[model samples]
Target: MRQYWVAPVGPFHTADGTAYATSITLTDVSPAPQITLPANMLEIGSEIELEASGFFSNTATPTLLLGFYLGGVAGVALAASTAVTTTTAAVAWPFQLRYRGVVRSIGAAGSIVGQGRLYLPTSLVASTTRFIPETAALRTVAIDTTVAKTVTVGAQWGTSSASNTLTCQDLSVRLVT
Candidate 1:
């Protein structure tokens, strides 16, 4: 049997066009753009899909790091992207990311295997958006499926600057089985 659940919360985003500034440490792009998965909602073969889009601008070619977390910003780490150096400076570039995770087990020691890709622009040209695949060899992480889990995405800049800012415009989560 198969089932699906569209998240009831959002398509969430930052409020009032507020953009999150990057620091040397990772931080949530938008605290409000998170989804909570109810306890026992996942089983073997169950899958989760997360889609997000945002715009970023930098004054310097800083190294950017992105991560997915199972709790809040400081919670259990699910996956992290390899450091990507910004190709351009002072240009507002738009990016999109999609992540998929499948439950491999269900329990306090449950696990999920996942992967994702980022569509990042190298320039203002439409065709310049490059597909940056997650190069992690193994993204299997232990999770507690018996309790509710909040998922969020975060980012950091290797070199912090006031001009190095990012704003998440949209985020959606879906459940499938």
Candidate 2:
């Protein structure tokens, strides 16, 4: 199976070009064109940025989960709101992640801001968590292409709330080493 993923716009180069092969093409569009990257193309020690925007309006409080995933697992917690009101929620997160053999280093930060109706009993809260292996044996290992992790942004409505729409307007990731 081909693992399709997103990438940044640039003439990027790695230490050894052989390990960093990409298929980049440009097409004419409106103001800006589009660029596509090969499937499952990611490198360690790369900096990534992701942003998601949408509107959420509801009559009652709702639970929402927003965060980033690496290696097919939730590595970083960008935002988590157990109780949220009707509002426009947006997530802007940036982080640097790298794995060297059995060790890893990461520095990340993000925010979940909202704007909702005034004078209503509304509340919005957010928290973050670092990605840690659940299994003890998995801790001392290397992240290869098969297990090569990619960056992902996500938001979920924890409950079946009425009159609630969380439209994810944009979800983008960029590599910056």
lDDT of each: 0.72, 0.31
* Residue pairs with clashing backbones, model 2: 71-149
Task: Give the alpha carbon lDDT tens digit for every residue of 32-103 in model 1.
Answer: 645788899888988888776778888768888766677766876666666788875747788777778889
Report backbone clashes per prediction.
0, 1
Ten-residue segment with the worst summed lDDT in candidate 1? 127-136
Report the error of model 1 at residue 76, Å.
2.9
Candidate 2 TM-score versus the reference: 0.39
For residues 1-177, what per-residue lDDT tens digits would candidate 2 score against the true structure? 745344554322221101101111111111111122223343444334443333344434444443333432234332222232333332221212222121133222211221111111133444233332223344333333333344333344544544433333333445444
Candidate 2 to native Cα RMSD, angstroms: 14.9
TM-score of each: 0.84, 0.39
